[model samples]
Target chain A: DAGITQSPRYKITETGRQVTLMCHQTWSHSYMFWYRQDLGHGLRLIYYSAAADITDKGEVSDGYVVSRSKTENFPLTLESATRSQTSVYFCASTITRYTGELFFGEGSRLTVL
Target chain B: AQTVTQSQPEMSVQEAETVTLSCTYDTSESDYYLFWYKQPPSRQMILVIRQEAYKQQNATENRFSVNFQKAAKSFSLKISDSQLGDAAMYFCACMNYGGSQGNLIFGKGTKLSVKP
Candidate 1:
């Protein structure tokens, strides 16, 4: 498909276990972002990648790690997942830096027990 | 720092009626971008409408429109003739064009419920 796609639409993991959420886009956008959607917190950016190897932290990036080895894939990893990490994760991409509406994928819901 | 605030956590309107969702933000920059995104039960983030800070005219799309008050830092969405399909979590987001790469700072969403 031409749009972004997320893997494992639903997931359940145990605390202290490692889990990775995958995001891939067909547009080859230079900017890719990972955000977590909680009940009251809305969507908080976890990590963002400017290019293939350049990544930056967002407001709530404490418990997450991200890597962008290629332009199409930006994967978020939890070194040691916690119950608080149980939320919906979304991946978005945009072609322009300061302009353009973001294209998002169907979110991945992760529940940490 | 730029922060978006949605004062209404939830709102309900009967079908065929109209409703408005209020959003306020704080920022120092004069020019930026504002957006309203919809998240449905399917959980896909959809861009409902957008407004540019420099534009004097409000942005509207079909039944969705934004009453953007730049001086007051207010951006509200008004859904006319609301329908069941409009039931979703609507988020107000802001992105500063000052050295940022389209990273949206979103407010706590306002859940819209359309009742029969």
Candidate 2:
């Protein structure tokens, strides 16, 4: 109840439909990151936010849009989901950018049909 | 850019036995941090153990210990008295402290199976 949580633990969407994964953390960590895990590739960072209104691209950010309006919430949206985008998305939070351990959520499993 | 590599894609250990998972990294910076994370079927990334590069001593947490060779740039995890709960994917990660921001660069991961 007091940790990072991702909504819609399991989701199925059409290839062209829009989908958004919500991530919320109660720790109020300054750094929030979104990563996609797939076979062979492992975990690849999609986007990261240093603080409110401050976000940066990661290894794979294409087709993914992230916004951090509030420190507790960081949402990742896919404008048009694709079959290639089907993977497990994880949300993590860190108290500081200098040195801190990351706390991950349960993960959101997305299946694009 | 720092790169972490886990040579063994999968490994199996009998219950109550010991097993070691190998991890190697390439980095120019001397000061950094290394971590081992376990992702079970639940998909929650849990920090198993961590080692600071500056510390010459290895880091250990109960049944989990790291054999960190600074010179070789190798960090392998040894799990003793393995249990069925130990069955999961373990990932080795590296974080460079010399950089402006310390972001973790993770390896592909090694899946460990605990056999009865």
Q: Which stretch of 10 consecutive residues in model 2 chain A shows the poorest summed lDDT?
A: A93-102
Stretch of 10 with least lDDT, candidate 1 chain A: A94-103
> List-wise, what DockQ does each model earn?
0.75, 0.61
Write candidate 1's Cα lDDT for B1-116 as tens digits: 88999999999999999999999999888889999999999999999999989998999999999999998999999999999999999999998875565699999999999998
Please give, as one word, the docking class of candidate 2. Answer: medium
Which segments of candidate 2 are over 4 A away from where they belong? none
- Poorest 10 consecutive residues by lDDT, candidate 1 chain B: B95-104
What is the lDDT, from 0 to 100, of the residue A64 in candidate 1? 93
lDDT of 1 by residue, A1-113 (tens): 66999998999999999999999999989999999999989999999988999999998999899999999999999999999999999999998777748899999999999
lDDT over C-alpha atoms for residue B24 of model 1: 99
Worst window of 10 by summed lDDT in candidate 2 chain B: B95-104
RMSD of 1: 1.0
